[model samples]
Target: MILAVDIGTSSMKGGLITKEGYLFSYHRVRFPLESLKGDFSFSTELWSQGFLEILETLGASKVSVVAISGNGPTMVAANAQGKPLSPALMWNSDLGDSSIHSSSYYLSKINWLRENEPQLYEKSDLFLSCPEILYTQLTGRSVMVAPQEGYIPYIWSDSELERFHFRKSAFPEIVHMGSVVAPVSENAFLKTSLKPGIPVVACGSDFIASLIGSGAMKPGRICDRAGTSEGINYCASAAIGDSRVRELPHAVKGLVNISAILSSTGSLFEWYRQLTGQEKNNYKETMDGVNAVPASQGHPFFFPSMKGENLWEFKKGLFSGLEPGQGKFELGRSVMEAIGFAVRRSLEIFEELDLPVHELRVSGGQAKSPVWNQMKADITGKTMLIPEIEDAELLGCACLAATALGIYNSVSEASEDLVKIKHEIHPRKEFSDIYDIKYRRYRRACESVVSFYRDYPVSE
Candidate 1:
């Protein structure tokens, strides 16, 4: 059996997968996000403890292989001995803001580290993601930093590393996802009830894994990831030449993956729920209420950038033209419409780049909403497909394990076998026509607000 673990934003999930592509037993444990003022982070120690507890409950004898998929773009600074210097800055955390975006910023932080916590930084050998950090903690061995496509220090080539004065020794050696990092150590055996020598495979980022798991193997196929943060990813034979598209690492060689992120999607709905004092019920009820209401003729534009935008602009959210007693359902519908519009805008960029987009595969928490799915289909004017597995990210990791175990010849072949289409949501002609207008309005709103946010200086 293969053990697949997904270290998510809010919780951790473990699944036991059989050789025949069957998911047997799954376990989920919730962990708290530590928010110290504006700095959001997660406790590495707590995560380690949680893993041990879950393994103990699973009974070590039942598991054979271990694979991990985790959130990305987040770095954990660690000492040469594999000890953490501080709480991990999660992918969602913006603690390093400018420092994360610029190499010069890192230099500044290094100076600050030297002044404030020099000893800790001195001991630190590398800044790695959760998977590398966890692997070191578990096996007392270091694994290489996987190449992430875009954002912060572009994938460091050998020359680029020299230019940046980065030490290769400080970075772990790169290993392909699903490659065995280390055998289960005596410490791991005592911490978890698992037997020794089980191979642990390092999985890729959740988004990349989800694309692989979604069976979007052929070029031009796109997947809409409507979770806490919305991501529209498409598989291409070649990397997008456009500046707007973010080129990311693909598990399969030669094929390139490009994505546009919304920075907020389900998060907007969550905010609406909290604002209306309806936090208890599922989002289905809220979406259902919106579906009952007619599409607003006025087409009140909404910019759904609740978590400071990406892809378009970095600004707080906005809802324009709110009349007194406009009804919460209208507001909710507007939010959904806004999200759909944002996706459409992203697709427009793909169109400009001449990227082929044939089918749309939808997944994540938002895929559960029929209303939202329909809206997305109409707005994009493409058939939206939902896979049999809701958590494509987890299944993607499992697919890698299947390949490593030789159950399938290749990642693409394993994806073809494991991914099954659940259903298709086709676009409604009338709804599509109406959404065309709303989408145009959304673009105009974005153009109007972008310059203001970018140029206007705010008082400190």
Candidate 2:
């Protein structure tokens, strides 16, 4: 059996999988509220606790290999012994630059530490990403996991390191995903109850793992890994150099992953529910209210963002076409519609770039909502594929472990063997036609916001 784990922002989820891809058991552990600080920082100890707790819940004797994935480019300054010197610098932490085009921004976190917490910075032996820190703790080896050579620039290029004036020694040796890092150390075994000889396989960032787990390994397949934020990962054969989309190497070698992120898909729904004083209402009730409001040409429209050409130029959300009788239900429907429209716009950008989206493999919390799933299908005019394992991140780790252990020839092959489609939602022509017109209006309203913002540019 393989022990697969994915470390998330607020929580960690893990599961056990057999060599044949059967999931034995799964568990999740969340960081205590007290450990998570308001400044987008959290104690790294929470990760160790979560790992041990998961192991406690799922006994480790039968586990042959361990594969772990985590969120990044979150940086953790650690000592020579793989002990954290301070709280982790989260992915959302302000590191002076908000750009994701390069890894210089992530290095800025280390710079911030040097300037603010000079003592800890000087004491640190290396700065590691979220998952690498945990791997170091388990295997007593400090290394970085870069999905491919192209991704090295997005992590730490030699030029970026020189430009930032940081010593290369502060960084770990770069390793590709699925490489056996090392055997679990005796110390880790004593602390976590696992044997010391288990091989620890590298599973890159959570998003990459989700891409593999969702079976988005082939060109034209897109993975909609939705959570608080949504990532539309479109796998392609060639890398695209476009500002509208970010391109990186796919988990499967020789493939490209062109992606865009909607920063507030699921979170926006929750935000609207809270703002409308429906906080007490359950998710089903809120979505039910949204479903009751019929989708029509006259339905209220909403624009959840006012982003311009620049990714950082996000302003206030706009709610257009509100009427006298319209209340929470209308507004709620508009929110859902806005989310759908946002997804369509992203796909349109991909289409323009010649990366045609064949279908969407939907995963995450929003995948549970059939109403939203159907709305996404109708709005995007693409099929929605719900995988048997909705938590594809954990499954992705399983794929990595399976590949590392020679259970499969490669991660893509492992994914093909393991991932099974549970349901498929096709677009309804009636709703698609209505949404096609609504989508045009949504674009126009977004253009209006851009023009308005240009005339009266926002102040930072």
Best by lDDT: 2
Candidate 2 ranges with C-alpha deviation above 4 Å: 31-40, 97-105, 157-165, 277-282, 297-299, 309-314, 323-327, 456-460
Instruction: For candidate 1, give the lDDT.
Output: 0.69
* Per-candidate RMSD, Å: 3.9, 3.0
Q: Estimate each model's TM-score.
A: 0.85, 0.90
Per-residue alpha-carbon lDDT of candidate 2 for residues 394-455, written as tens digits (9 for 90 to 100): 88998988888887888889999998889999999999998898888777777887788779
Q: What clash count goes with each model?
A: 2, 0
Would you list the clashing residue pairs of candidate 1? 144-172, 144-173
**Total colliding residue pairs, candidate 1:** 2
How well does candidate 1 match the true structure in TM-score terms?
0.85
- Per-residue lDDT of model 1, residues 234-309, tens digit only: 8888876777677765556777778887776766676778787777777778878888878745535666543233
Q: What is the lDDT of residue 396 in candidate 1?
A: 82
